[model samples]
Structure formats: C-alpha cells, structure tokens
Target chain A: MSLSSLPSVSTARSTASLTADAAALPPRAERFGRALLGSLLPLCLLALWALASRQGWIGRDLLPSPGDVLRTTETLVLSGALFHHLAATLARMLAGFLIGAAAASLLGALAGSSVLVHASLDPLIQGLRSVPSIAWVPLFVLWFGIFEASKIALIAVGVFFPIYLNLASALARTDSRWDELAAVCERGRLARFFLIALPASLPAYITGLRSGLGLGWMFVAAAELMGASQGLGFLLTDGEQTGRPETVLTAIVIFALCGRASDRALAALAARLAWR
Target chain B: MAEAVAVRDLVVNFGERAALGPVSFTLAEGSITALVGRSGAGKTTLLRCLAGLLAPSRGEVKMLRGQGRPRIGYVFQDARLLPWLSVAGNVAFGLTHLPRAERREAVAKALAQVGLSGWAHARPGELSGGMAQRVAIARALARAPDLLLLDEPFSALDAFTRRHLQEELRLLLHRVRLTVVFITHDLDEAIALGDRLLVMAGPPGRIVADLPVSDTGGALLKRQVLALLEGSGEEALQSPTLRVLAAHAG
Candidate 1:
C-alpha cells in the first residue's frame, strides 16, 4: 500500500496498550499501603526514641522521656494553656501575614509595571531583604515597644521580602506577546493590568505567599522569644528557665507540627490558585 | 465605500537600527493581503504598527473607517490565550464594552464559527494546540472586527491541523468578508489564501515587491517571490535589471 493509504497502525496500537496498562494497575488500597510503607523509617525512629528513654541511655535531665513529655502535654491540655498559646501565635501570624503580603504584592506589582518605581525602590528593598529577620528584632522592639505591635512588625518584615522579590520578577517576566492582543482588543492600560498581567503572574504570587508564610512562622517565634507573656516561644523559654525538659520538647514538637500543617494548607491554596 | 488602509512612508527603528520601511502601500477593504518574508524581515513590526501596538519611528498609518474608529482584531504566532480563563471567557475578553447578553451572544456565535461550541468551559491548558489556536481565532471573531491582523497564526501547527485550519479560515473569511492582512513564511500558503502578496527582504527590512496573485499564474508568482527573497533580483523581474537595481538604491 502507498504511504497515504497505510492504516494508522501505530496510533491504534498505542491506544490499546495504554488502556491495557491502565487496567493492569493495582487498586487504591494497595497504593495506600505503599505510601504507608514509605513512612516506616520515621516510625522506627520514634520506636527507638521510646526504647532509649525506657532504658535510660540518655540522662532524664537533658532529654526527657517521651512519657514525661506526654504527661506534660496532658497537663497543659487540661489547663487549656496549650490551646491558649497556640491561638495567640496563630492570631499574630495571620495578622502579620495579611499585612505583609498585601503590601508586598502591591509594591511588587508597582515595581514590575513601571521602570521608574523599579529603579527607585528595588535597590533599597534588596538591601533590606539581605538583613536577617532576627537582626531586625532589637530595632523593631525599640520602635514598637515590647507589645503586640513589635511582634507583629517582626513577622510582617519576615514575610515581606520573598513575596516582593518573587512577585516583582514574575510581573516583569510576564510575556510581552499578550500586550499585542490587548492593544488589538482596544483594552486600556488598567484593564490589561487587571485581566492579563495580574492573572498571568498568579503562580509566582502563590509561590511567594507560601515562602512568606513559612518565614512568617519562623519570625513569630523569634519575636515572641525576645518579649511577650504568651505563645509557643515563651513556653520554650519558660521551660528552659524552670528546668522542665518535657515542656521544651513539647513546645518544639508543637512548632514542627504547626509549621508542617500551615505549609500543607498554603500548598493546597497554591494548587487551587494555579489550576490552569 | 472601500475603506482602505493607507501606510505612508513608514519606518520603524530600534535604537540606531532600522527594522522596517521607507516604503508605502494601501490595502483595499474586503481583501486578503498575505505578507511573506524570511525570519527577522519585520513583517511582525509592520503588523504591530498597523495594530497600534508599536509606534513607527517615522510615517503615518491611516485607516479610512466610515464613521467611528474601526474595530481591529489580532491573532499572534502563538495562541497567546489567557491560561486562567475558559475558552468562552477568552473569546468574550474583547467584548467587555458590550452589554452582558450581547457579549454572551457574540461569544457563542464566535465559538460556533470556529467549531468549538462544546469546548466553552475548557481551560486553555486543557485544549490541544490546534484547539487553542481555534480559541484565539474565536476571540478575534467575537469582536466582529472590520480588520483582522494575523501573525503566522497557523505556522506552529502540524501539516494536517494547519490545512484544516486554513480551510476553516477561508470559510470564515468568505462569510465575514472582513479586511485581513496575514503574515506567513510559506509561499503556497500566501498563494492559496492571499489576493495580493507582499514580499519583504533585507537586514533593514522593507517591502521588496507587491504582486497580485492570478488563479492561473500562482506558480510564476511564487517563483518571482522566491527569487526576490533569495536576493536574485535580476532573475526575478523580466524588465531591465539595472533599472530595478537603481530603484532599490534610490
């Protein structure tokens, strides 16, 4: 047969094979089992920790037994202190994150869209970003005092840089080809910004938000450590001063769990925003 | 009224370098003009000038609209659809000035025209390349433009999809009868679709030749266009070669 008249054999074969391969895949339960198996090492580490504690291989003063940590957790939960501290930390994190994210996105967009704004502000912003969040703590404390304002300011500062840099770069890098379409469609400058430029930069903006929130959590701890009556940071410091290793371990665990949970939540949000 | 687009001594320069034009042309309304050129030939520069996306360093482009400003639609080399929007939403983008019902009706009609009526809710990322290009065409159609500018709209597609889309575009033009200026690198495409073909050439690009495509003389015209583009200037023209050289020099 001539080339044009040949049957589309390869196409048909590929489709059939794809269908067969999909059908041959294992069930959902087996996939779940595989995922669970992947976590075996971390579970083993926990088992080892319990074993070491029961045998007293490590001194109780330096490293509290898992049982001791659990008992402390129970006491804290019953007295509602754990929930109180967690709630306070969450509130501070949310407030600072919203403020910082809002400012960064607005400024970043301005810088990205206009050459003048970028030239005027980018150097200073970049310079400030290089300074560690912890280094700003003393200055923030002096400026805002030892109140909630200082803590919030510290968290907000921590959250600002990643979001600003990411969003500004994203906006600047948005495809110029779309501008031609906008012109032909007779869309005005403002309309193009809202409908095209902003939406196009969303994936980058979402990424910046995730990174900012992670840093926001870290800064909140630093802020609370320096001064403040409540929060996880305070609990850690207080545990140290009181010689309660169990309380310190409990606080660290809570911080890790909360950080992971918040990161996961932000990731889900980013996925939803980046549905395209 | 023939509503022609008259370009007068247009020149575009980037920094110290000229990109296109110390040339002039007029495209009569309701006609398709295919602009064929090599890469970096400034066909895109000319199109952008016409679309008012880029300002020419020198010269004026006048579109003789009968009344108000003429509505213009443009399709780029790539689909260039907004990824966040659905097919229908992208089509409806230019129709925001219209009333809601009118916009919806326009979008539906455009989608139907492009054979994408059922894919209205699909995101741009979900569609295949051909489908996305069709959506881009639908977006241009939804505006009901008097003039449509296409910059290599089907050049990225495979042969089968390109031919299919070319046929569909021809049908669309026959029904709409809008003025069109299409850019292409394919000589056959220019011959098949254009009523008039403009060939561009040079490091500092300019339109080298403008010829009408006669039904029986497409092959001869293609040969001439190829010769001109390849810088075989003397061989392309049957008239005196020295005169053509003098004209180019001047």
Candidate 2:
C-alpha cells in the first residue's frame, strides 16, 4: 500500500524494468541515443571546468571559468553584439559555400567527362589543393580588399578542392552498366545526366558538401581573425587586445557551438537530399 | 522456326586487334540457342553483340522481329544487380518509367516468378549467389523482352541451384515463348538448354561445328557426341576439310 501510494513512480519503475535492454532497440534509435550522449559530454566538461575554477584549481585570468564565459556571453547577447558578429560570419560562409559547390560541380563534371579536361587541369588542381586557404588570404585581401569579397573568396577557395575531387571521382566511377543500359534505352546526354549521373553521384556530392561546409567555416574564422569589424573571429581578436579572457572564451564557445550546429544542419540537409 | 536474328560475316575488333570475326549465324524465334566454346573463343563477345551492348566492328547484325526495335534483355555472367537496391528494386530497374502501383505489381509478379516472393525487400548483397542470379533473370523477364541473352548466368551456382535454375529457365521460356541466346563453356549446359548447339573456334573465331541437340536430356546423347568428336579427330588427320576446322579450333 505504501509503494502503491505513488502510482506514477511505480508505473515509471515498471516501464524502466521492461525497457532495460537498450541494445534491443533499432539501429537508428541507438545512433540517436549515442549522439545525445555525445552532446551531453560537452556540458559535463563545462560543469567540471566551472567546478575546478570555483575551487581555485585553475587561474581565472589565463583560462576563464565557465561562469565568467557564460556571464560574458549573456552580456554580449543582451547588448546584441554577439548576434551581429554571428550573422556576418554566417552570411560569409553561406555565400562562399554555394559559389564553391556550384563551381566545383560544373568543373568537376567537365574534367571527369572529357579526357582533355582531365589531362590539362588535374595537375593544376592537385597543386592548388595543397595550398591552404589561409595562404591565399594575403593575395585575396590585396585583390578584393578587407570587405566581404575577400572573406567570401577565401572561404570559397577553401571549400572548392574537396567538392571538386569528390565530384570528379564520382563521375569517373559511375556504373558503366547503368550508362550502357541508358544508351540502349536511347536516352540522350541531358536525360542520362538527370536520370542516372545526378542520382548516382548524389551520395558523393553530399559527402563533399559536408566537408566543404566545415572547411568554409574554418576559412571564415581565419579571414575574420586577419580582418573584420564584426564577427566571432573579430571578437576573439578584440578580447586578446584588451586582455579579457572571459570575452575570448565566450567567442570561442560561440564559434564551437555554431560549427557543431552548422554540421547538424548540413547533415539534416544531406539526409533529406539522399532520402532514397 | 522463322529466323529472328541473322548475323553475316560479323567481325568484332578491340581497336586494331580482332576478338572474333567473319562468323555467320542465324537464330530462329521462340527457341533457345547455345554457344559453346573454350575461354577466349569470343562466346561472350558474340552474346554481347547480339544483346546490342557491343557493336561489331564490321558486319551486319540483322535482328528480324516484325515490330519496331524489339526489347532485348541481357543476363550477365554475374547477377549485376545494383547493390544499393532491394531485390524488387533491381527487378524493377528496367521499369523505371512505370507508375508506382504498376511497378509494385510488376515487381511482385517478377519476384513470384523467380520463387523469391518473400525476399522482395532483401538487398542484392544480402542474397545467396543463386538468389542473385534469379534476381537477374527476373530483371530480364520483367521487361517482357523479345530476345533474352544470357552469358553463363548459372555458371557460378552450386550443382543443385544450377540444375534448379536450369529447370526454372526452361519453364520460364516455355511460359513466355521468348527467343534465347545462351553462351557457356559447359557441354552439359549446352546439351540441356540449347535447341541448336554452336561450337566456336579460337583467336578470330569461326563456327567449327553446329548441331541440333533436339529433345535428348540424358548422358547417352552426350557419350554419342563425345564418340563423334573422337571419331572426327581421326577424320581431321586425313581430311583437309576437317583439318582446317580442327586446326583453327585447337
């Protein structure tokens, strides 16, 4: 009677007992559970950081406590400074990523389809890909100025090579049998591309897109660090100049959060694109 | 037994090098023909040409079916089902333009025909070798093709599965009444499946022997054929006509 007094708690206990074997769940559900656990790990780390700082186990000035970083983040959010910087960085990334992906796809398709294109451009692409996006920042700044163009250009260049390589390889390795079947069906070039080539290369394209997006973000951060009035990267530079560890930590946290969120968004988009 | 396919002086070359050529043949409709030869005897090349997957470098391949271009289907040596697609999807690949409901019905009918009704949703990679080959057959049959070309479709199967598929193929052919052109290295297969048996010679391939196996399925005819081959071997030593054919085939 005493245990039955809390009926809801008793029912919850019974449900928990029934669902004890977590491994019996479907793979998709299991994957989601694992991702949720991974998400919680960062929060746990933050809590631990806050605890250690509170106990004076770590210095607050050199490495700001989680509380201090949170306070700075909250102040920046209230004043609307963080939002402006976040928006700038995001806009640059978006513009650059789209341009890069489109260009890569077109050029890669050409290179993959024609022997002459491959013979002429493959070496050049390989050489250029070895050079980091940051290395181009100086020349980009000189040519395009400190405005949005330089930043976007730098990000686009950063994203281009991976997408190009993936697309080219995808085209090269297309199922010859499918192509032959299409030929037998009397499908022309355009029809073949839409019906077969595009769908066949979609998985590779999405994979490249994911990598490109990540690279775009990295390049944006570097571009912002070099020069930019309003961006998370600028925030880091400002914090360094003023010797404010809390502000620096806040900017870093925001950058990391945005990067992880963008990855999830891209992953969601990719999953939708490749639903088949 | 009207001629459905007629090939005259068919020459296939890979760039400058000839694979097989100057071989003339005719195939009758609603009957199965088997091309039996050693490896590199252009059996596959000939089948591929008949399937329209490969164009002969020189020669006329006149396929005579009364209608517009007849739908020709090919079953490769391997099943060649798309790994990403389910067994049903693989069968329905040629039916891509069909409406969803029609495709579903077609897929169900094909899977049922192949005795794989319950395994519709299974991926090609998940299936056994024999099951995959059945899926390939289903893929071809689903198209309702006028001519079906099979290149060693059951060569890799275990003895039981091979025999089972052979019987299934025979039944399917009877039900559909479609023309078949099969290529194989096995005499037993040629004896079992073929209406007309064509034996090919090496290098620039030519037809050395052509025989009608007729309705004989047992080994008696096989032994008789072997005896004839041995008897012919001695005849080749003396007769110039047999000598050239033997030399080229050897």
Q: Candidate 1, residues A64-103: lDDT per residue as tens digits?
A: 8888999999999999999999999999999999999999
TM-scores for candidates 1 onward, in order: 0.88, 0.80
> How well is each residue in B92-123 modelled by candidate 1, as lDDT tens digits?
98986689999999999999888777778867
Model 2, docking class: incorrect
Lowest lDDT 10-mer window, candidate 2 chain B? B228-237
Residue A259 of model 2 has an lDDT of 84
- Best by TM-score, which number? 1
Residue pairs in clash, model 1? none
Q: Interface root-mean-square deviation for each candidate?
A: 7.7, 18.0
lDDT of 2 by residue, B1-250 (tens): 8988899999999988889978898888887888876677788888888878888999988889858876877888888776656788778777755688988898888777777777788766556677788888888888777788899998987786676678777777777788898987667877777777776666566665666775744375455344434433234235554444444333
DockQ for candidate 2, please give it.
Answer: 0.09
Instruction: Quote model 2's TM-score.
Output: 0.80
Candidate 1: segments with Cα more than 4 A from true spot = A1-34, B1-3, B233-250
- RMSD to native for every prediction? 4.9, 9.6
